[model samples]
Target: MKKEFAVIGLGRFGGSICRALSTEGMQVLAIDKDEEKVNEFKNIASHAVILDSTDEVSLKEIGISNFEHVIVAIGENIQASILTTVILSELGVQRITVKAQNDYHEKILNKIGAHQIVHPERDMGRRIAHNLISNNILDYLELSDEHSIVEVKAGRKMKGKTLIDLDIRANYGCNVVAIKQGKSINVSPMADEILKEDDVLIVIGADIDISRFEKNLVIDD
Candidate 1:
């Protein structure tokens, strides 16, 4: 069977993806134009190769089209990134996720048929900003442009309240999917379960609603 993923680049973003996928025991082919990078991941990925991904014939020789998902992570070089994404699209890679260096790069990638375009730096900036807003917000993940999932500490405002008493879903339009205290996580927490100051609530909803929910209970405290 073909590898499940192919990552074409060895920069911070691409290398991180390769490491995570490999750590998950997935079959990943790590490709890069730099020999040193290929050597670094030699034992990590299912296969590591030093090749110019922008060269169509080079990609075909390595059977790039066979991978179920291909990530174009050529760093800095917008030209190479666009060319590789275009070739991957033409080769009918089932899923092509490309890292956009900037807005212009994203637009060109979209025009050429990139299945998904990621702005890692931009997204990370948002995540950092959210975390900086208040110490109570432990983490944040963007589900979509308008939707997000946040892990926030239950502060003084929520310390003695129960899920139902707080009417989180009805009033805030956010769902408390889980609660964690210490190392224990309650994935299906009951509505009557009283919260503690140390509890961390994993909530998911529209970004605006989540912000409103946070402002009242988190920032207000």
Candidate 2:
């Protein structure tokens, strides 16, 4: 069965999501206040509508609550985004994902019952900054404000040590979730799995613990 989704606001973020969901064979309803934006996605999405999302009456008339998931992607208008999210929550939409422009916006969205809040731009910036700051740190993802998942290149000190020998969970307060070598990855690696130089380790734990682990495991280059 195809999952139904409604994307509110046809800006770059919303439009891209609609196209991607449509490409994955989902039923996507794209909405926007601009007729041109709506028309632009006419052939891409299952349906496109031009309406003011802040207006609860208009939303109800269009049956916005019928969709399985609704995305509030209004970028410039924070008020509209918050109102739309509130309305969607009141209408009992199964899931509501909102694009937050900043920390303040994210707090508001969370308070209004948004299921997920995305800081796409901020996240991307953080990733880029991490890569720039440390050559060995391949990637970083924030699981929460405190926890994180990071991919770092295995150092010389780590080579030839099995998972049991390293005792990551016991010593570092983190787990080696995966090992990526060149073109291959071992997910949920066994306790006996050995670490090799140049291999990338995907570790998950609290941000402070992960940072400590990285500092101790990864050699500065």
Provide C-alpha RMSD values for all models, in order: 1.8, 1.9
Lowest summed lDDT window (length 10), candidate 2: 212-221
- Candidate 1 has what TM-score? 0.92
| lDDT tens per residue, model 1, 1-221 | 53599999999999999999999899999999899999999999999999999899999999989899999988999999988998998999999999999998988998998989899999999889988999999899988779999999998889899998899889989999999989999997999999999999999999999999989877744
Index of the highest-lDDT prediction: 1
Error of 2 at 5 (Å): 1.0
Q: Which parts of model 1 have CA positions greater than 4 angstroms off?
A: 1-3
Candidate 2 C-alpha RMSD relative to the actual structure: 1.9
Q: Which ten residues in a row have the lowest lDDT in candidate 1?
A: 212-221
Name the runs in model 2 displaced over 4 angstroms. 182-184
**Which whole-number lDDT from 0 to 100 does residue 54 have in model 1?**
86
For residues 1-221, what per-residue lDDT tens digits would candidate 2 score against the true structure?
99999999888899899999999999999999999999999999999999999999999999988999999899889988999999999999999999999999999888989999998898889788778767788999988889989888877768899889889899889988889988999999889978888889999999888877877776464
Count of clashes, each model: 0, 0
Note the residue pairs that clash in candidate 2: none
